[model samples]
Target: MFKKISWKWYVGAIIFTVSLALIFPLVGLKSYVNEVAIISESLMIVFSYKLMIKRLSGPVTFFLGLLVGLFWGVALFSLVGVIYNIN
Candidate 1:
C-alpha cells in the first residue's frame, strides 16, 4: 500500500504517529507497526478533508474549509510521528 501512496499521505501519517508517541512518551509505544497503523488512519482523514473541500460552495465553505485545515493539521502530526519512529 505504501508503494502507490502520495507524498502528502505519507507525510500526514508520520505526523500523527509521532504526536501520539510524544503524548504518551512514558509508555514508549513507538514501533514500526504502530507507526504504520497511525499513518494509515491519518491518510483517511486527509483524503476526507480533500473531498470535503469541494463542498465549500458558500459562506459556510469558509468555515468548513477552516475546519478541514484543522483536520489537515492533525494528519500532518501523525505523519511526523511515522517519520520520527515515534509511532
Candidate 2:
C-alpha cells in the first residue's frame, strides 16, 4: 500500500517530526520535549510496522521493523536531549 510513497515523503515526515522535537524547547515547552519525542517515535514505529507488513508479508519482518524503529526512536530521543542540554 505504501509502495507509491516517494522517498521525499519519508524525508519530509522525518524533518517535520524532528522540527516538532526542536520546537518544543524553543517555545519554552522544554518539559514536553520528551513527550513529543516519544509520540513521534511511536508514530514512526507504527508506520514502519504497517509498511513492513504490507511489503514483506511475514511476522518476522514485522519484528525486524519494530526493532529498527525502536533503535531509531532511542537514537532520536537521545539526540533531542543532547541538543536541549547544549542550549
Candidate 3:
C-alpha cells in the first residue's frame, strides 16, 4: 500500500517540521505562533491528502485542510494560553 506516493510529500513534511522547530525562537507573540502552527498543519493535511488518499479537487482538499488545520490550531492555541498563564 502507498507504494506510488511521491517523494515530494515526505519532503514537504520534513520542511514543515524543520521550519516549525526553527520558528520557536523567533516567535514573540502567541498570535503569530498560532498562525504558524495552523499554516503548518494545513500544509501537512494537504500532504496527507495527496499521499494517503486518492486525489481530490482543489477546493475539496483546501476545505479539508482548513478544517483540520483550524482544529489543530485551537488545540495549539489552548496550550499556548496555558503556558502564558503559568508564567
Q: Note the Cα lDDT for every prediction shown.
A: 0.54, 0.73, 0.58
How well does candidate 2 score on lDDT at residue 28? 86
* True-vs-predicted CA distance for residue 28, candidate 2, Å: 1.3
lDDT of 1 by residue, 10-85 (tens): 5666566545645554455444444545454555545544555556564565456556556655655565556565
Whole-structure CA lDDT of model 2? 0.73
Q: Which ten residues in a row have the lowest lDDT in candidate 2?
A: 1-10
Name the TM-score of candidate 2. Answer: 0.69
Q: 1 or 2, which is superior by lDDT?
A: 2
Candidate 2 per-residue lDDT over residues 1-87, each given as its tens digit: 555676566657767777888888888888877777776676676667666775686787768777877887888877877887834
The number of clashing residue pairs in each candidate reads: 17, 0, 0
Which ranges of candidate 1 are over 4 A from the true structure? 1-57
Model 2: runs farther than 4 Å from truth?
1-14
Pairs that collide in candidate 3 are none
RMSD of each: 9.5, 3.4, 5.8
